[model samples]
Target: MRGWIIYKQNEMLLRQEAYEIHRLLEVAKEENIELQVFSPDQFDLTVTRDDEKSILIDGKRQELPDFVMPRMGAGTTYFTLAVIRHLERLGVYCVNSSHSIETVKDKLFAQQILAEKNLPTPDTMLVKFPVNVALVEKQIGFPVVVKTLSGSQGSGVFLSKSPGEFDDLMQLIEATSPKANIILQQFVKASHGRDLRVFTIGGRAIACMERNSNGENFKANVSLGGVGKLYPITPEIE
Candidate 1:
């Protein structure tokens, strides 16, 4: 069987997890499976055929892969999702559905979905035009986090420890990025300085790690030079 792996090339710098794609491909090859990697811009969905036959592109006919592994990052956005949709139409199995990816990419939407499902998540607010910065402050209070609507690897995220700080940051952000909407959330004190990073696949935890930031940094992302240690997945984590 053949498979296609779609992912962002630049994400390798911030999140080295894309290296795992190579490992996965190696395993697939060991099992005698053919795999191909394509950058988001390389594929053209406009000329794609729907039948279970090969689609011609650039004078070459290529069969639709048996499955597609979407390791798309926030930067890929619409193009990545478009490729997934095209593959789905051609009967390709995606590791994570396009809708699921989209839902998770939107921080506010994800929080709402998790809350509706009775999943524990930090309190968050979404602000659009005519920003009600005061209302957000009254609700989530001080020491809140402000994150871009679409971001990953802890980029475009900021913490406001007080009302004055929050206002100053918001003003600066608004002046620089007038078109951008922000997601403000009440910081989870319990998870402060640390959090659990659990790799879950097929509803099962495979590997887990604990990340603890340095005393000077509040963000515990490994990319941020935070210390990490392998940890066993306990019932509490589940």
Candidate 2:
């Protein structure tokens, strides 16, 4: 089988995870899986009046891979997902379908969908201009999680520990970014700045890691200096 991994080339190279990538490549080679890597920026899409489409990567028309795994975290969402959608039109299967990924990428939308389905989700309130600090407090209480519409590695996510903090953060955001989209989410106090990071593929979590904020921050994000420890997948995690 042949597969493609779509990733940000420069970022991954800078992170120096080449050894990890090489190990995966070696395993794939042994299994007769032809896996190739392509940066998201390399693709150009062409659409025609006849409702036909083709792609040019590096200025050359390319053959479609059997499967595609987009490794993008938070940036270039629309562009990369567009390519994934386009590939789907050509019958290529994405590890996570473009539609599903696109839907879940929007924090508010995901919550709304989950709540509608009666799925367990944090209580959240989407803010409009002139955000009501009192209403936010009444809905989510103090020490709430405030998250921007787009963020990764816990960036743009803040914890408002008090009513005053919530007001200040909301007012600052309104002043600086009048049109910023944000949400106030109820904090789960029991978690205590720690969470399980589950790595899922084909709908099963194959590996897990526990990330702790190191008692320095409220967001236990690896990019934010959180310590990680390999963990076992448990029934609760599933």
Candidate 3:
């Protein structure tokens, strides 16, 4: 058995010590599966005149893996997605389908889908220029959470404690990126300094953790100085 993990080569190299990739490789070894890692740029895709699809890795034809796992998250670019799509065409199964990844990359679209499914989601509104402060006050209220449409690891996220702060932040954003895509969400005070993180595979919850802010920031992201610990997976969390 063989598999591939698609991640940036540079990042993998930098974090090679005590990284998730090493753990995955170890598990694969125990299972008698030869798991390999490849950067998106390593593969060259081609479609032949006879409708045959072929991919070359490092400029040489190579055997396809039984499955692929794209782990780039927000770092995933159009080219990366294109590579994944090409892999799919060649009948490679990918964890977290490309379509789902694309949809969730857009914050508003993901929230809308969750709400439509009757999931309990914070009230969210897409922001537009010549901003509607009145509507925001009435609908979302103060102390809102502002976020860029596509971000990960708590980047491009901000908390506006009042109308003035929100206005100032929006003006700054407009001055720098006039056509920036942003969203406003009603802040959930109950989860202010901490939140539950759940990991799922095949639609089943496998692990749970709690992330707490470092007593300074509102975002409980470990990359931003947050602390994490194992947490019980209760029925409600599931």
Tell me the RMSD of model 2 versus the true structure.
Answer: 3.0
Worst 10 residues of 1 by lDDT: 8-17
Worst 10 residues of 2 by lDDT: 10-19
What TM-score do all the candidates reach, one by one?
A: 0.85, 0.85, 0.92
Model 1's alpha-carbon lDDT is 0.77
Q: What are the runs in model 3 whose C-alpha is more than 4 Å off?
A: 10-14, 49-54
State residue 92's C-alpha deviation in candidate 1, in Å. Answer: 0.9
lDDT tens per residue, model 1, 135-227:
877888878888999887788888889877777777777788888979888888877778889988887889899999867667888777788
Identify the runs in model 2 with alpha carbons over 4 angstroms from their true place.
Answer: 10-32, 48-54, 199-207
Model 2 TM: 0.85
**What's the CA RMSD for each of the models?**
3.3, 3.0, 2.0
Q: Candidate 3: how many backbone clashes? A: 0
- In candidate 2 the C-alpha lDDT for residue 58 amounts to 79
Sorted by lDDT (best first), the order is 3, 2, 1
The superposed Cα distance between candidate 3 and the true structure at residue 139, in angstroms, equals 1.2
Off-target runs (Cα >4 Å) in candidate 1 are: 9-18, 47-50, 56-59, 129-134
